[model samples]
Target: MIISSIGLSGYYVNRLVQNSEEIVKDNYRTLLYIEQMQEDLDEIIFNINNKNKTLEALQDYESVLKKQEANITENGEATLTEQLRVGYTKIKAHLEESNADANLIFKDIYSTKKYLNKIFNLNQIAVKDRNERAKKAADDAVLYSSLFALTAILVTLFYIFKIPEYLVKPIKGISKQFQEISERNYNVSLDESRNDEFKEMALSFNKMTKRLQKFEQSNLAQLMIERNRLNAVVEQFDIPILGFSEKNQILFANDRMLEVLQVKKENIIGKNINEIVSNNDLLNLLLNQENSNNERQLLRIIVENKERLFSKRIMTTDTEISNSDSLAHDSIIILDDVTDFIQKDVRKTQFMATLSHELKTPVAAIEMSTDLLTSIKVGKLNDEQKEYVDKINDQTRHIRRMINEVLDLSKIESGIIDFELENTEVNLLIEEALQTVQPFLKNKNIRISTEIQEQLPIVKVDNHKVLWTINNFLTNAIRYTPDKGKIDLSASLKDGEIHIEVTDHGQGIDKENQKRIFEKYVRLNKNEKGGTGLGLAISKEFIEAMDGKIGVHSEIGKGSTFWIKLKTNITS
Candidate 1:
């Protein structure tokens, strides 16, 4: 600041000096020219009638006056100098003629001298005025420079003293308190008198410390109560629960878990899970450090000589080692016993068989009745009578179909569905599916096209179930498609699999309904004449059971393309 002030003040001083020197030098030169002009006038007076000497002196005098006129410094000096030039011109007029009257010449010279004297005095006053202004400017420059220096000094000294006290000391106090907080010490204070941001911060810090102190004082008992409550709640859960540290130590074992272990919950706490569980495979799987939080798998544990299925739900916490006081456990292991579910599934399958047998007798009787009515064994029936018989037969068949579908659903869920796999030619399977659905297509006037890739590899699948799935897709396509619409059946060897696609230009399913279309009993727009919505679900089951994939690509108002891909038999 001092240096800058000095530089700026020196800049003003230098500008003033330059301007003042120019004015003073010009004024001095003008004065010298005026004095010389006066001397030349006197010489010219003596040299009158000496034509050469008189003319030379007259020229030199004119030159000096012109020079002095150009250098006029003050406001009034210009007029005074111009009047002197007029007087000199009068004198020159006389000298140029060389036959000039003495009185007229002397009068002109006297007039010239008076004007010159006036001009000189004006310039001298201007010089004095300008010199005083320069001095004043110099004094003002010094005063301002001193003032700026003093202000800078005061600011520097204030910062030097006040920074350490008001800024640095408070900051240091806060920092030291924070350091103490890092060491788990919350008993610290800071100055709170200063009205600044730091004061607010200090107050906040002190409040935080007070809160932390209060928390530290009361935290343990409250935490113990909450922990006990949480433990009790978890213990009351029917499902087993366990918590493990990163070191695989059992931090918590609930009552259900203790029952599974055949030990007291308190006895298992703090013991490693490896020490409690005898199965090394299951223990190693749960204690595997590489297991990520998203990982979950089925595990079996033997209790009282019987094996129980547990869904090993492993959950990892976002606990950082740097935060030693974090409340989060390393990992939480929730063991949900799915043994009852498995048994129930078996019971469900057995119930399906029982229900199917009971319904089969009634269904068979109705079917037999419909057959006899349609036949001529009962009586010769007219056209309307035969139509009623046929309708009754269709209704009976539909009921039977629904019952069969229900059984199939149960069987699929219970994993009891049998599949006869074989290496079947792709084109033959597609041909049989198309042939079965041809009569339905003719009813709607829907055209069929095929694009079977030549020399396609044979796939290993259940031919009946797989063909039934294909026929299901084609039937749906034929039913929903408008009359005269075209359906294309294409089979190809793609990505090392035999892909069969049934594409048709029909009123496509909406996006929201497409995902759930394959689920059990989910139908889109019941207004359309479609089956019980179990066809696609059964189709998905059959295709998946044969290790094939089934899906549909559809857009509303465009069309739908249903596709299936079956794995080809890998040749050794």
Candidate 2:
């Protein structure tokens, strides 16, 4: 079939070359005839010495030009129209100017002849080049045919002489071996020492077949053992474990996965993960990661039909050793049921909010009562009454502070706190925060000092959160400092981070209590002083939300220095 196809193509190619050569020859012949006639007319006009002789020669040349024009038209040259127009114009001008005058006629006719010679030369050169190309094409076709014929003969001999023993015999033997293996017969083997490479290949092939049989038996046994172990693991654990393909096909589903969906493994395996999860949007996210630039993904996906929430974490691993690209591989997705934990968290947050609100009312009432008792206009009071009233006002203020702290905690836990992020100068924010607490400093009689870095780069952060964090540190510092003790507030940019520190001369926090101070209700002592245990905790949350961190260093009876670290760049 291949040889016949090649021969047919070669025949067409040879025919096309012959046709092209004939066309070139016809074009060259017509161009040469026109040139020769033009030259003859020019010679007759240029040699004219009398009016009658020039007219006789012009008439004769005009007849030859007419015949050449007809030939050009018949040859299909696009230049024929231009040549005829020029020739006719020259003839008409010669007839009018000459008045049968031979010299003028000769000038016009000679100019026309020169143009004709130029055209003839161009035609001769073009025709010669085309003829050479045709000759080369013909020679190439003959060479290609010879090579094609020789290749066909070689291919025919190769197949006729060796196909029976090398290809046909081996194929038949392999088929017989497959039949025997199916019948559980292992004694059958292909001979190896037949003095041919085909026999050697068959022997190697038989060895591979036996090894594959053993491997299949071993693999099946191991797979069964693994399936049992997987079932046991799923039975003991409440979380679901699943395996899915890039096409969203489920390869396996553990006991937990089947139980959650209220379906048997047989019903789910080989089914679409989207149909099992009952969510299209989440299914797309999971499947797209199989070809993603990133290798792992953890996301919260809600199952639409089951009305269940899952925290799915997926990772991909390559199974083929010969892929051109590294990313074409299968992925394993682990679906953990987070529905209960999510519900519990929601309840905890709601209780915190409700408790915070309930605490606010009593705190407000106490503040109102303290205001009435302290005001002389409400009722007159003696020295003892005045002191008691002053104490009551102070304690009420502390209660109000604690209530605000609780409210802040609730906001942090529920993610309701508004973080107004923008470009803020670290130095300016720290200065403003220090001023806000300046009034509280008057009662303590502490000397406050600051060391702000010069030309500090601006940071993208929530100004309010940054100030709040600084204020928390300041409050902690002032509360612990004794009367007239020195407190220092400083800021600096270091190692691509902004550091804000507040140091005091008060008794410092114990080492044991310092670590847990960020936790809610983590006061070292209930009666240590006024203020809620939530201030430090709120500070931590505010700083973290702004993508910063807050911590402290202290020694008992010496002082405590609380510091906050913020990144200079704003990124999620």
Candidate 3:
């Protein structure tokens, strides 16, 4: 644009100069030639009319007219100069022919002079026209030149400053972005305002930053997913699990832990564990502040003034596992409730020990006294006295049986029962049980059906103990079963274990009472000739002591099936 403006200004300046030259060379010269002709005409007329027709003056007048003719350069100047030349020629001829006719010569001179005046006036008009044209051209030159100079200066300054700025701005931005990237700032972005390769470079850099941002977000999302999964699992669990950091900051707690602590999960989470550790010795011990390898059991924690027993296991973060899983916790404190089991065990032990030690001698003395009274060796008894003695003896024996059952239960629960485990045939134990309950079987008129498997696998068990548990089951079946009802006894192998089941067609225990049936002195039906309820309880302990599982499958209004499962591993 600037170059074009300069070229245009130069064209306008040349035009102005050419117009000025036309006014000077054409109009001015024509006017000067006309003035010289007018002066010489007056001299020629003066000499001719005075009758002093000097040849020099007449020749000078002719010479001036010829010069005026020659000076006819512009348009219309030639016509006027030609008219003046013709009139001058006629006057000069008249002057030469009749110099004595002054009036006639003066008339020719006056006509020639009128032509000269016409030429001079025409040149004057021509000069005005050329001058006006020159002024317009001059105006055009001034406008164009000013525009050219202004445009050139502005363009030069723009290139000197703005061009470098355009280059350095993006360079600085890209350099600063590189610095930011080195500092791990992935959010820097450049403005892609220009339609240049620089725009593409900015876009590529933006894409790179976007990819970095996406990768970072994806990793963060994965970690959040893992953490949320762990939280969901712990939230739904019933076991009390409390996880904390090394700084004693509680990371999280399960629903059960929150309930046991009587605090909300929101209340405890992110708080220091020391907030809840006030007067909580069990937590302190289980946390292993003493750093002992020993485990803590029977940790009694009181909630709402009600004490609960728990066996706690503390787990610390494994560096190898934590390194593999970034969301792994620092430490976990897990608690298992053992309140009922421990309480029942302690009460049963104390009661049975007291009963066994305190009642054994008195029961024996009562039995001996009743026997002696019945023998009639100390005194002669009447029939009524003898009958009472027999009843007393029966009661004493029943009491002794109940005491023995309690003692056996206490020993079984305490894990103090002497178990002489050996590879024994389960069929033999079933036969022995049948033989032992034969009197009760006959008295109740209950027929025992045996479905012992052929070539039955030998089971590792305490032989006598197994037989005793089987006999207790048979006795209970015989007692609960109606007269003439059939009882089915079967032995089968299941999952590498021997299952001995005794099914009786008797009143079944209810579902609610089934769980408590094996508990001490817990008889579902008191009216059904139950033996102090300790028989089944003691039998359960005995079977369990021999590494066997015993349970009764019963539903209300349905017959009961009692089963004992023992592991089968035969070794001679």
Candidate 4:
């Protein structure tokens, strides 16, 4: 824009100079015409003063005067033209007078010529001023062009010399250093001696490099610790540990794993899992790579020379296992020795079966005695005998409830019970669970309050399973709460989640026992509680199968709260 303005101003100055020159030329031409007219008038007067001149001389002078007058009229820039006309009029008047009169008029003509000279000088001065202005405008245009050229050169120099060296070079150097680190070259470092931000950045980079090295070392240390823990756990237990790959390679084997496979550790390490074991079915499944995200099945198998049945759990962490072009790093198969757990389970099942069988005899005998005494078959019973029979009946009833609770616990621990899921109102479940424990609340003289959100949506869950979990919470609350204590049941919807909470003013669980409360056969305080210790364990399994979570909050000697969270609108 500045360049264009300078060009435009230069063009305008040139136009003004041209117009002024034309005016000067017109003024000079008009001055010449006035001079000619003045000369003609003088000649005509000269002829009249000589009185002896011929008529032809007078006629020639008159014709010359007429031609000059025509020229003066055509050129209007002549300032002397008006004076020339006045001089001509005076000369004509003096032509009939004496020669002395003509001389005076001629003096007036000279004076007009002097006035015309001043006008011509003024025109020349105006032309000189305009020329000077145009010259200054040209000089300014040259200066503006030089300045713009200089600015452009400086800008280009900045881009070439300053930006590349200071900004681009540093950025590229940092990028190269990162690329080297990504390729696992941890030795690379940014140069920081410039004493600028790059230097500070380099210092930070060195600090981060050291931190990464430390983290890598720490991660290795943790892996060693975890490996040792795993080894220790394997040694302490009789379970076998086996490692396998997709190509049927038996990559690893613990001492027990080798013993169970009836081979040495060295022999088992390089052998195919299928060759070392009796089952090739697991090999087929591992070979058939399908969806990566799906978990592989745990297969139970009987290996050669090992009477105990073993299960193989296959696991892979491939994101594209089903893709033909995808390459898997490894597949791990953990061989767990379920011999002891299975034996213990079998013994437990047998004991419960035997207990059930043995219980019938005693119950039948007591029942028959009571019937006989009530029928009065032998003799009329006294008040004390009747009272004893009643006590026996009450004792039988308590035993029966205890037996039923024990059997339920056994079924739960053995994973035999299946949860029947259906849509049910959580508030109604809480109310039912509360009703079951109302007698306990009354006995303990405790106050119970409930707050259920109105219009609470129904949850897809197993009614019996949810009721059992609620019963567990209330039972724990009742057992731990003191007399006249308070218990609260609350349910609400928050952040698109349904929350059910049970709170009690009881002796809260300690930190140590809180974590273990959900474990099978685990109780928080066994001395103060009487049960088979399966309530929380059963409740947890049931809730999880229905896609829910359970948690507890407790502080010693304060109180405890149990809460359950479940997803809404579950279709399956």
lDDT per residue (tens digit) for residues 1-572 in model 3: 66777777778778777858855676777777777767777777667645455456667777766766666666676777777767767766666675357677678778877877777787787778777777787777778678778878998898789877976886787899989987768888988787866898888888899898887789889978987898899988778998898788988788888767677778778888887677555455666555345656557788658888887877888444433555444889888998898888798798877868799999989988887886756989998988898779778877887888878877776778798888888778887788888877777777999998899887778888888788878877887789999999999887788888988888798877888888878877667552678888888878876678999898666789999988877422
Off by over 4 Å in 2: 1-219, 232-238, 244-251, 255-306, 313-333, 378-380, 419-446, 454-465, 479-485, 492-499, 504-533, 543-561, 564-572
Q: Give the TM-scores of the predictions, in the order they appear.
A: 0.55, 0.49, 0.45, 0.45
- For candidate 4, lDDT tens digit of each residue in 1-572? 65675577667767766775665564455455445544654565566447545234434445644554454323243545456456555545555465446557567656756655554565456557666776676677667776886787788888889855766877788889888877656777777677766888898988887777777788789878976785566566556665566687865657765554456767666677667555544445434536355553344555665466554565664535443688666665566666677788779876885696678678778878888888856788889988998888877765665566566666765777777778888778887888898877887898778899888777888888788788878877887788888889899887666788889887788898889988877865658524667678767877887888998999988899999887786332
**lDDT of model 2, residue 446:** 81
lDDT of each: 0.80, 0.72, 0.78, 0.68
lDDT of 1 by residue, 293-367 (tens): 566566788876889888777777765534476554578878888889878878977797678768989989988
Q: For this target, which candidate reaches the highest TM-score against the unseen true structure?
A: 1
TM-score of 1: 0.55
Q: What TM-score would candidate 2 get against the native?
A: 0.49
In terms of lDDT, the poorest run of 10 residues in model 2 is 72-81
Candidate 2 lDDT over residue span 328-415, tens digit each: 4666666766778888987887887788689888878877887787777788888898898788877767776676777788788878
Which predicted model would earn the best lDDT?
1
